[model samples]
Target chain A: MGPAVKLKDLYFKYSIHTDRSFILQNINIELNRGEYVVIAGRNGSGKSTLLKIIDLIYPPERGDIYIFGNLINEKNIYEARKRIGLVFQNPDTQLITGTVVDELAFGLENAGLSPNKIKSIIEETVEITGIKSLIDRRTDELSGGEKQLVALASVLAMKPDILLLDEPFSMINVIYKERILKIIENFVRGGKTVVLVSHNLETALNEALNNSLMADRCIIMQSGRVEFDGTPASLFERKAEYIESLGLRAPIAVRISSEINKNIDRNFPICSDIKSLVKQLTGLKGKELKK
Target chain B: MKELIKIKDLSYSYNSQNDSRSIYFRNKEKSSVLNNSFALKGINMHIDRGEIVGIIGPSGAGKSTLLQHLNGLIMPQQGSIYIDGKSVIDEWDQKELKKFVGLLFQNPEDQIFEKFVGDEIAFAPLNFGFSIDDVRKSFKDFLEYFGYEYSFKDRLTYKLSGGEKRIVAFMSIIIYDPRVLVLDEPTASLDSENREKLIKLLEDWVSSDRAVVLVSHDMDEILRLCNRVYILNGGRVVSEGPTENLLFDEALLEDNGLDVPEIVRLYLMLKTSGFEKIKKFKTETDFINWIRELKNHA
Candidate 1:
């Protein structure tokens, strides 16, 4: 069994005001090893704050977060942070280097990787991301998605043990949106832990949600608390209204499949994939329940 | 209904490398968005007075490009647009054209110039030489309608949040009360509650016989507010119809660069999967009611 992430009633807040202000409260989630997870909710639901906490960009006010069986505290916080890579919501904020080539090598330099290996990693990253032509372009000129790819290329060069993304595709064009999803999916398949925070319920379900359906878990935050935390299937299997009531959109597939079950007036699992939903429908009609 | 605006085979193309390179549309080298291409082509669309029309398509579908033409922002290379039967693009003066149709760009930050919030909101009308008294009456009413306190007038415009910036952006046009308003991505970054309010404000504006054109990537918002939707792809109006068609046509939306509303997909799945064969819903509630009927009949 591989080491997994554990949260012990973790309390996270952005400000010092205890009684009035708290970004996240009473969050207890366990992300399994090498799992691809999505934490989704409305804006200000603490999705971004949680990822920032996991990424060690900010400290949790109360409770402990364990990554790979190691409790994150002051002692190991510096060492533990090396394992996490966060592709932030705003690309402009994360960018430190003036040029693309420097950005690709920035994290590796931070990790004290040798110069020879650094050159090889940068080449592989720029080539794989298809940003070789764009390496020389100024940061201000790149479009929304291109900037994100540059940001991602930099992170991948570091080769962190776990990855965290905060609305990584929010500003990009649709073409790059699909491309980043594929890139992130492939990155997860390589056996590195990945957790994402996004308000884009549709993409989360269609792209990463299914890949992490059974093995991985997601936490739905509401009013600064964990509303639902479980496998994707488990979350959709029973509760539909609880999510909808919170002004959060369920995965399109889940809602549609559920609607199918309702229209046909029969119960079935919410399947994100079209093929599986069709199969489920086929099986249901095979029985030919009296119409 | 008054014919607020009209376009007759409107066409426009920009030099990609040379944003300032071309004087005429025909001189542009590219026929399409192949590196440096056409932003719009043969766009023949119109909005009646008081019509709340929606423009939607995928990311690069030229929705914004078409909206820019409505207000005379980018002069067309080869086309004619008539506002109130007047050839606004071909003939009207710049100041007069701006008063009839105010075009609101997506990023409010791009539009902001004045330091104070009040100054920014009042800038457009002031530039049009509106009397100070009229601007005062209109600005106060507009701000109150959107649920903002009067004191916000004193604050710095740039310091406001994304949602607040959008409100200020809309107010800039509304203070002058343009008969035809065009807004791009009106609620792109707003939270759910604020988004609802913004929609309501837009709806009221449209209902006043002051035609409003909304260009949005969020199909759900358009489905709720717009009476008619024009689906633009590759610089042409490939599909234009009532909200029912745009919202229900999942294939048209997805292929054209939009994710279909969940209700539409559900209706589609049910239809294809041997449940029923209905293709439209005016709203989610309407769809829900229809589903319940489907179950009852089953």
Candidate 2:
């Protein structure tokens, strides 16, 4: 099969009367089946705009987009969107139902599924997302993080072929963050595509490095253009200053290991977590003791 | 140190008649589940002048509820709050208390309602009866301070990005010069550069008589900006201490649904690996300096 998603020379601007320049310009990207890609950049860099274009919420000013070997146009826009599920950056913007149960059922109902089918889908979804406790709660009463989880659960219940998440972890706590990452891992394991946009590259990099299945590609955007596109490991291999210059922070392990490499003039493997960094440093200490 | 705000046995529940009725109509099974629980339970805390006090916990831990009480948006049902040594419930009206304690809500769109950026920044000051000329002058100065062009004020508020909207909301509150600034997840959607700019702005804004109350899920920000932190779990203070001591407790942080800041984890790991001389450092630069010392000794 062709790539899960392909964008060619895409350009987008909010309004011709108000916007003087294109908010997203000359974008070219191809995502494959089961690929997990992270889009990282500063605010106003068109990260969310890019996601919107893929989800068919925003019509591009120019260029072509292909999903599952099919061109995206008005004739097939709804069909394309059915395969794509987008969880917006602000949970409030996407949550429209009065209760969590209804929220989860809205998409399935819209897709014309039977009540029995919707119930089974919701049961599986709530179990996967671990939001069963919130099934009957009022949406407005949920805290920001709980609302975020509910939004994710609602999207996951649809079982889209391509999942696009925009800053889903911004408001959630650490525990929920782990659960969300695990959900993403499981989804990708099912041979589906996942694209996540995050401002915190450190967390994304940590997950990508620690778990082999988390992120396969990392794309860095700046000023409405892709600046770097490579594996997360390769992204970290660049100078720490270069990453910081792009408004991204290097993972703590990568930063510490790079500093030590520069000081000792040795090529030590970059690590993504504290445990691995400690092991490398302890090995170095043992070598010094022997010398 | 002078205490700018104090809460005594403050408690709040969301069991209002209207709320109960709505819950009953919406979902009968869930109404009983929520009607009996308190949003905030017997919380006592204080914020001193020239300090940034942090409140952190998992979702629904009453962080926002507590912040709302700080500015009298929500009156305590069972206890009392004092601002500048004056009882919030007895001595001050909501408007007066709001001017003294400005709150920036979690969602910037909630706090921002004006059309233009300039108008939004000026709304609070103008409402407080400040001269229009002074407000305009201060607005220009604020733009210049933040390195924004004067024309930036003309941009439509709705057109601004998430980070820009947050900055506008922050400016709206600080324009009126509130004694206490309460920020709910100020850095939630901000990028690295904007986050640094906000940290510097907060450092520059606080003075001997001014203070801030910050609620965030970012442990790094909590460690860097706050002097004291209170970990609220289930609407009560489960742990409270100076930032350095409190944040380093990995077990406490994890139990409260928080991640240990990367630097803290690194420091502990290094110490356990027998780097005894390395001390706890707040910033990455300090850690780098310690690493340099170790290299030179080697």
Candidate 3:
């Protein structure tokens, strides 16, 4: 019922000097549990910094962050981190061991779980992630997408309540990207909170629609501040202004929809997925259905 | 068009024993799978001059490896490479290869080591025996062409943002004016504005005397810029054709670990759903025009 993660007046700067000094100022957001929230922003807009702060990697200069209704402090930071799984853009950064099986076992081992328990968890994770074939492969041999999956599996092996993925789909192939999205869908259906920072909003939009699980909120960040936050559709409607003002590209669907809406007096539905967009076009008032 | 980079039956394998440094240092191999953990099996593609050739495949599909071979970063163990009709293996030396092929690595941090942007861009040109005056003039021209301020040359390389660093890294390679350019995900970190600028720069710079080989996961960029696309799956060429027809085939794309662009997807979906009239649209603008026509008829 409460927010899974809450940020209040978060302000961060690497240093005090003013010239090109990095700053994340006056940030306030409340992400409810079991909700999928996408954080879209241009590079260096503090998207990754925000995720790092949530993971307790960076201590905010001035702010209060609550995780699972518990205020995060130095005392509770480690405990809070245990409840969250953070995957970065490059999976290799987080991977520790040589083999996939060993990599998955490392986290559980760190948590001091029994060897038998770790084995069972690894088995279940491989099944859930559908990476059974990769169990014996070397971490260095895995492709970028496979590497991301292994990273996800290693993180999920800990059974964290919250998932924070920063551009997990950036280097992944399309098919593997779909598989990763399906895994994320399953995670959401299981009532876990997810905050994904990605540039590929179109893929995310399609995945959300296909699963019948639209993003509860979309937050666009500009200059380390929250520019817009609302449903995906609302975000699409104002995409032009965001593109111009925030320096973020609107999804292809949003771009086309906006172009049509601007030139036509009649309202055309903003369809995020290709199927729906086609339906809207072919099912127009003046169009004749073949069937 | 002249064939700039040609490969036939190319296969490369990274064996544990083949790692010379590790073998010399440790006196033994590290991993047990000594044969070939990562291998490109029988890859063949010809990159023509003045055109952008795209390589797309699933992760670990050896796309990056394929790009490396074009520039001789990775020597082919099984096949041959021809650069402008000359055998890459026999005719090319380290300096000749370095002078003839410019590779913009996947990660800027790996390639850009100089403290200042000016020195970073000037390194390759100077290394190849370019006079100091020529190098300076070329670097300045490159910065101006990319819309980067002359002052950017003085900025710290690491201080620049990810996109800026990538651009600088790319410019560093281009200053040498290699006959062939290979880019690994050039637009991965760029914002929309910079991406458009870089696309325009590529269009202006790539000509019949020069060619480009681009390896990227972004299908849209591949569709927009590349004249021809080669889809590699498991280190083998699964498909190759003109960009439009290759990207238009939804099933082929999906099978090769790729996806059609959203507009193309919409067209295919409508065509399959009994909207035969959708055949007229190939791009989003075409579809928009069709929508305008429908609005007028209404």
Candidate 4:
């Protein structure tokens, strides 16, 4: 019915006793329903802190947060939290139960869903995430990547209106990473909201190009403030000097494209993948045409 | 080149404990464990002084298990390891082992414990019987090399950022000056600028009397830093060769779930698209130079 998340004049600091510097200062942002947003920054630049605040895990010292246009406060905090699901960078932190099935069922059980409904949701989540083989395996016995798949399934079983993933697949292997990205693709295509935080250049590029899951907005944070906010294309096209100064990086294809453009003094469009980049470089429409 | 470390017929597996009373022990699901067999299977590798070697593989391929064997953190179930001409299986003194090989695990939080940064870095060397004056001199040299100010010595280890913590972890290890340095995903948390700085620092380190064994998923780093590489899959060495040659094998790399570097991909795509003039270049600078030459010809 309204923007999925809205934060106004949010200000936060760890505590009054610690250094008085604000950890987050005068933040204002709004995400419409079905929008995909990426928050990128160097470590300790407050990317995780922003996600925590949005999930209401860390309360802002000042300002208002509205989820789906309803202001969040103690009176409605529990109800609001039910509508948001969070998956952390480390799957071990979020996985509670011993087996995958129980882990997926834990959240639904807490929400007081009927047993049958829980079972069906778990099945659907396993099918979507393609973690059917891992459904019965013990969480501790699973590898880092497998644990992340279980974590994603556990969160998706709730069917929350807003999904927040904090560096969700950085430690995962490529095979599981692609499957996880596929799940995210399906979720976003179904007109849901996602806010992903990461510094991984490869995943960002692949998700941007192959899936056409371009971020509606990209926000780069620095020293507890938004240094840059724009489209993903603009973020990748920023000068190397500036991006490096912010302690971030562009994908390798983008980097090569930039160098080629600089050498030729002609703006060859930035291609997120190598195939398209080669196409642009040779000025060929298709592979057959070149042959 | 004489081998500093030799791993022969190494194999390891996690045995399900008979005591299942622990909270983490799920006795019923023991058979369902994804990898019930050897985490590492009859692995063999060698590291020589002044060599930079990279070990890469997909997750669950026993990359970390292989690293743990080099420093005797975990003993080989079936084979032997030799460090500095001494068999690690027969000689299990970690204190003596630390003098020859310094291992930095993937997670810095697991390795760093002292409250202050200076205390954290100084703990190991002091324990190893370094005189106070020697420790002070080494710390000063590290400060100058890493470009850290004197005031940074007082900062708490836990309070530092992720990248800063990794750098400090590296400093803690390098202060000891082990002949062989084993680093697991050293650049995972570092920003690109810091990563570049680390590459240069590693290059300098490996050019001298020290050898470094790096384990990572970053193909670019492997291609840039490592002279030799071993590709592991399912706890076995799938391929091992010079970095340039092994990385160029697209089928081997992709089948192992490793991403081919984008520049290499561009070369292949151009060749596939019938651009006969495209040539393979090893590094970014060479690639850029070739591009400039192409522009000039055009």
Candidate 5:
């Protein structure tokens, strides 16, 4: 019921530049605790920069950020980061250990949890991510999807209240992508906050919309500015314009469904999984047709 | 439609076990770490002179392993590979074939090593025995196409962004003017804008009569570029056919752990909604146009 994180007039540019080539500028938003929030933007729109700032990895040049009602300062940066778990875009950058089991357990150790407690948490997270089968396997030996699951398990094992993941599903195949999505959903349901930076627009946005149903929040960024901040339905109002700012188009499902709904009183809903969207729309068909 | 690259009943595995060197020295008959596993299992594939084929499957499907076989990176254990009417295994001459087939692996860090940006771009042409003058000219042209200012030539490679690193990797591959291009996970880490550029690049390559084989998990990208799709599952080419057939083939796609495109599903949904004629439109533009026409008819 409280704000998990807050960003006020945040501006972050490359450290080398005093110029205006920032990834984000004049950013303002609030993320609630126990929310699964997805921040969508085109590449170079500064979504990752924004996440790094929130996770306390990158301090903003100017602006204010508060974590759990506490203003973040230089002294408490490490403590803030420990409360927020960030699974980097490249698993290689994030996975420092040599093996999956160790990788999954490292974050807990870093969080300074007791060793026995870390073990129990790692066991639970590994089981939830279904990486128990892959725990002993070499991180390099595991497939892309398996490595991605290990990455998620590592972060989840830390049990941070606010989890920040950048392109978490990029390396994964669709099967493992679905599995991680479920685990993330359960974490949010259990009152953890999540902010995900993703290149795959459809899945992250749809999942945030479906279970949360715009109940959390969606922040669409353009040129380092908060272009739109509202529920999914509100963002859908200026779908074309919002997509252009996001450096993408309205998703195929939204496009097709809206197109079909143009001729009828359509719900024009958006969903990530095309198969499930098909089944839902097919259910609305009057009767079985004679093929 | 001549055969460009061919693999016949090939198999391979990694000598990954720690005891392989020590144990093998002590006992020469010790089995390798990849003893039981096969990276590639009797793969038999044929690419025409200019065909864009999409290889799709879940993780650990041997997609990356198969791409490595085109060049001499990893020789096949039990099978033979032929490129441009010559058997690569028996003939043992990929000097020109290496130039013909340019491979871009997943990690940019794995393939890129030069310090300066221009040197990194020129690394390939230099390897192919191009004269300094000739390599310099080719590097200049690719840098121009890649939209790098002249100032970027001396910049450090690691300082470049992820998208920039990938562009340099592509430029390295393209400077040689390879006849066939193989890319693994080209669009995965890129943003939408860069992803669009790479898509356009592939679509153009497909039109240029240069065969391009892609092993990617992005179904939307596969639908857009590839006319033919090869679905690999469990170290085998499980399904290969036209892109239209592959996209509509839900059972095969699902079996291989792939997601069907959203447009196709919406198209099918409109079937019993009294619009059953044009339910197979592939792209966003095509589907939107279908709905535009469906409005008039309805």
Candidate 6:
């Protein structure tokens, strides 16, 4: 198959006459199947807008979009949307059912699945998302993080070929955040595509740096433009200035390794985790002692 | 120091008769789930003036529920909450208590209602009987202090991005000049620069008579800004102490489904590696400075 998604010279604005500038400008990106890409940028940099456009919620003012090698127009928009699942930033915006179980089943029911199939899919989804306990509870009673998880589960139940998440970890605790990331990793391993927009640059960068399976590429948006599109390592190593200019700090391990390397005037590989970085530092200390 | 806010054996549950039309009563079979469980159970905590107190836990651990009681958004079904030694339930009216304790909800869209940013910021003060001229002046001063252009006040509230909406919600509350500020995940969608600005602003805002109660999942912010911390789980206080003491305890934080801040984790690892002279630094800059000093000594 062709790229999972392709956007060429895409431009978008909420209002053409009232707004002065496009929310997304001249964006060209091709995301491959089984690739996990993270889009990072400062707030109001149009990261979320780009996700919305790709999910087919917003039509671009000027651009061409192709999904699975099929051009997206009015007639085929619904077909394209069926293959993509978007979990919005605000859980309240996406959740419409009265209860969690109903919410998970809503998408499957709409997809015209049999009752048995829908039940099985929801059971499988709840197990994967670890939300089995929440299946009977009302959706409105869920905490922000719980609601966010349910939103993801609802999307996952649809079994979309491409998954787009907007700041999925923004409200979740660290433990659940790690769990959901693993879920996303497994999804991509199944030959699916995942595009996650994250405000937590450190976590996203670390994911890309440490595990290519979790995130293969990183794209930084600035003022509605794709300023940096490369591997996470390249973004941290060659485009540190760009990351700094975005008012985002690099990952802790990357930052600490760079500082240590600068002070000792020695080149050391960038480490993504604290444990690895510590090991590197201790080895360096031992070498210096022997000298 | 005087206690600005105190909670004694405070508890709450959503299983009330009046809420039958709400989510708590939507399903009779699942009524025993979260509704029957106390959102907060006998929670005892206090915040002193001039202190930034942090409340952290996993999702649905009653952090937000506890915060709602401070501003009278939710009434305690079991215990008492005192603001300035006045009872929130019995003594002070809800509106009066809200004036003293301003709350910024987890979602900025919850608190923001006005069309324009200026109107949203000025809403509370105008309703509290402040003069229009004074409100306008305070709005201008707020913009300038935050390093925003004066024209930013003209932007529509709904048109603003998620982070910008958060700033406006914060401004609306701060403009009223409350004695205590309650924030829920205040830095959720904010970029680093804006997050830094907020940290600095909070540092400057607290005084001998003012305090802040912060609820967040971001341990780094809690470590940097809070003087004391409370860890809640299952609607109860699992641990409470000075921020450094509780935050550095990886076991305690991990037990509550929280992550130790990366800098603190690094510090502890270094300490175990025999960097005994190193102190616990809250900010990354401090950690780097210590590394530089170590290099110079070598």
Chain B TM-score list for all models: 0.84, 0.92, 0.87, 0.90, 0.87, 0.91
The DockQ-based order of candidates, best leading, equals: 2, 6, 3, 4, 5, 1
All candidates' lDDT scores? 0.71, 0.85, 0.78, 0.78, 0.71, 0.85
- Better candidate by DockQ, 3 or 4: 3
DockQ of 2: 0.52
Candidate with better lDDT, 2 vs 4: 2
TM-score of each: 0.71, 0.94, 0.89, 0.90, 0.85, 0.94
Q: What is the interface RMSD of candidate 2, in Å?
A: 3.1
Give the Å shift of residue B146 in candidate 6.
4.1
Off by over 4 Å in 6: A16-19, A207-214, A259-272, A287-291, B16-36, B145-147, B272-278
Q: Could you give candidate 2's per-residue lDDT for residues B205-272 as a string of tens digits?
A: 99999999999988888999999999998889899999999999999998999988888988888888
What is the C-alpha lDDT profile of model 5 across B31-121, one tens digit per residue? 3333435656777788886788888888877888788888877777777888877877767566776887899887677788999888888
Interface RMSD, candidates in the order listed? 7.4, 3.1, 5.5, 5.0, 6.2, 3.5
Candidate 4 docks at the CAPRI level of acceptable
Residues B168-246 of candidate 3 have per-residue lDDT tens digits of 9999998888988899988877766667788888878898799888988877788778999998987789999998889
Query: In angstroms, how far off is B274's CA in candidate 5?
Result: 4.1
lDDT tens readout by residue for model 1, B107-200? 6776888999988887888889998889888888877877668877986775555556777887898788788889887766554445666788
Per-candidate DockQ vs. reference: 0.15, 0.52, 0.38, 0.38, 0.31, 0.52
- Winner on DockQ between 1 and 2 is 2
| lDDT for each residue of candidate 5 in A83-124, tens digit (9 for 90 to 100) | 888887767667777666678766666667887787778768
For candidate 6, the docking band is medium
Q: How many clashes (backbone N, Cα, C below 3 Å) per candidate? A: 2, 0, 1, 0, 2, 0
Name the 10 consecutive residues with the lowest summed lDDT in model 1 chain A. Answer: A206-215
Which pairs of residues collide in model 1?
A: B32-B37, B58-B257
